[model samples]
Target: MHTDARVLNNQSLIEGDICIIGAGAAGISIALDWMNTSKKVILLEGGGFEYDDKVQDLYKGKTTGQKYFPLKASRLHYFGGTTGHWAGMCSPFDEVDFRKREWVPGSGWPISKKDLDPYYAKANETLKLGPYNYEFDYWRKELKDLNPFPLDDKVIRNKMWQYSQAHFGDLYKEAIVEAKNIHLYTYANVVDILAGEGVQHISSVIVKNHEGKTHTVKAKHFILACGAIQNARMLLASNSQAPRGLGNDHDLVGRYFMEHLEIASSELWLFRPFPTNLYSWEYGVTRASAELAITEEIQEKERILNGTASLLPLSVGKHQKPRMETWQDEDPRKSSESLFKNWSEADEAAKSEKGAIERAFQLNTRIEQAPNPNSRVTLMAEKDELGVPRVNLHWELTALDKRSVRRIHQLIGQQFGIAGLGRVKLMDFLRDEDDDTFPDSTNGGWHHMGTTRMSDDPGKGVVNADCRVHGISNLFVAGSACYTTSAAPNPTLTLVALSLRLSDHIKRII
Candidate 1:
């Protein structure tokens, strides 16, 4: 059953077996798994069915350390959460992403990719995606024309990505509303978490809405399924009991903030026309596209971080500019429309100049940043309408991140030179070795991760392998906030897989 928290009386108490805060992809996915089960689940969403200006204002905060999108505009606060505007690109984390790399500080996950393989397959169904096969060879067999770049496997190999069009809210709303065991409460913004004696167990959560109604949700187990930034924000803001916030005894609640550095870094001038069908975007159907990724052998030899480079024809890439206006808007639907319009214009222009186009193409980089302790999200003194402190983001990038991008392009250019296939012109910022500062064109994927990072050691991470918050048995964290490393692909697929894994653990425990 679905209800609005605003309509409930003040100081009312709602009880459930399991309470999930934030009805995003993670929260909704978990709740769906519990449908028709014996468990009584309560899912809390901060906003209504659609976007609201007042609720969005709660996300407004300050940003420093790096030029970032306005805090208010980074994520949506509706029933579907950020998935409302997601493009649905899905790929699993590489095996190397889970291993411990000597060059990457604070790297490695307590659980390996193998641990989540079964769950990833299950997640594909929930995401409304095609087969879970990400192998280039598998896609080549399915699509006859899907040929990979003729590069040495030891030096560079092709990586695949699948697409999905499922918007959780629109696609699963009916099922969720009709589920007898699951209760979804909209406009139920979580303001605080009340802890029991000894600060070991969570007694209940304080929720409020703009209508001036307040209530307490009491559950045996509490899971924070909010996004990375907000997950840490709520933990930091709930300072009534633990002082440093619940499960934040080690001061590791919001540190090690990571983002995939998505930037157009160079231009590749090829000798011949590359097959557009293999690399260009495809809709509705699941297809594989090749991105030049360095092999693990080379990463070990050079001691560089993981990264991938994608090619785009110069004709289409030159017209592409940073959509700041779209990103700064509170409503994500506007951003999605703007993105589609921009892509359509570029596609039309590319087709008109098909024959007259040059051999040149743009090289885009999607590189992972090494986990740094200094990069974090802290609470600001200013409070929002709910009297909760707003967040101040300190997004810091390291020299290694820049070095990795430059090195990947350099290696790609060298291979092209040897094959007599193309020549690459490095971007101005990358040309100078001394200038480590990234250009204004450099932007993040807006994929927040690694805030409440997982580690077996309590001193190192906020949560353990099972996503249970250290020192707090009844409280757990969900979503990318528990990611130990941000891999090259988008985090949605892996995050949903992780959520499914967490759900199983909760079921086993409860």
Candidate 2:
């Protein structure tokens, strides 16, 4: 039956077959999966329908890594969550993403890529993507000869994969409001999870609002769908009763946070068939000549060969050379003076018809990072609105992550040369502290993961093979936080798939 959560204070506490915290992408996906079911489901959210100062205040913090004004940052803590501003880039994790690599210590997932293939297809459908194929050329032809910008100085090509255009609040509004057995509450912040006798049985969760009022929810099954950071925050904050936090028996609640390190830059080049707005409206990359700089095949081979990374195709802009900049080291292979001279000559070249053919695609690469236990999040002395401790994020990158960056650059340089994409140039003097885009410099990450990792053994993980919290028979996780490995792709698709899988398991239980 439909119920307004605000009635909890005057009336009785709400009880449900399943209770989910946070109404973001994963939470909404789970709610939608059981929309018309007989089992009662309640979805709790911390913020209202739109972005607000109070909601944004929760995300305020001192920057230790990537420094940017909080106002300009795209992340949000509202009803719809961060998906409101998400660029909708959607691509499934490759087979290698689920495997354990020797170079990537503490990597490898309990499940393999094959296990999620079917769910990946379902994720594509939910994201409105046409299909789940990476064959760029065949799809290019299928698009009626829509081509990528042609360039001669660089080997420029386009890569196509699924992209997402989802806004969970808007996408699932009808289902949520109309569902016979579902109740969605706004401005309901989950402050704590109250576990039963053994910390293995999660009996209820405490939620609060701006008015200093509190509400409690009891459920047979509970799922934490809050984003990676907040998910850990809630668990750690609920420590009044549990000494080490609800699922901190192994101290693996918030470790191995990761984000796809993106490098964007721009420069002029001598290439033909230039179009400034290449693939701006396409679902994926559009240029025809571009080859897969990195692929599942490459990643698998790398894993087998003990290599640590895979390459994806890089795209250059068509005209006005997209004005972008990042740091890099001066090529050691060529003296600085020699390269400077060549750059000066190229810079002096006129903008002619042939130069119009010269295209520049803004290229970005997602190099794999090896997991290090040192990079972690722990509880801080500071407390939030509910007199609970805050989370202290301690993120670090291993030397292997740096090595993978260098290796991927080398691989891209070689492939661009071999495929005649262009005169490939590595980033220059980036490690120099003086440079804005130096190696030691930090960047912001939207992909938060590995906080509550999944594993076959409960000793090494918080979630079991099926995503249920190891000791807690009724608690589960369905987001990037459960990932064991950070693949070189967006985490949304995989998250959606896992949420669906979790729904199946929850359905069977409730």
TM-score for each of the candidates: 0.97, 0.81
Tens-place lDDT per residue, model 1, 194-310, is 889889889999999999999999999999998999999999988898999987899999999998898888898878866745665666764566678898899889888888888
In candidate 2, how many Å is residue 19 off? 0.3
Best by TM-score: 1
Q: Which structure among the candidates has the greatest lDDT?
A: 1
Candidate 2 segments whose C-alpha is farther than 4 A from its true place: 1-12, 63-74, 146-159, 265-291, 295-357, 429-442
The Cα RMSD of model 2 versus the native structure comes to: 8.1
For all candidates, what are the clash counts? 0, 28
Writing each residue's lDDT as its tens digit, candidate 2 over 382-473 gives 66665556556665665555544544455555664565655444455333323433243333335777788888887788787788888778
The residue pairs found clashing in candidate 1 are none
C-alpha lDDT of candidate 1 relative to the true structure: 0.87
In the order shown, the candidates' Cα RMSDs to the true structure are: 1.6, 8.1
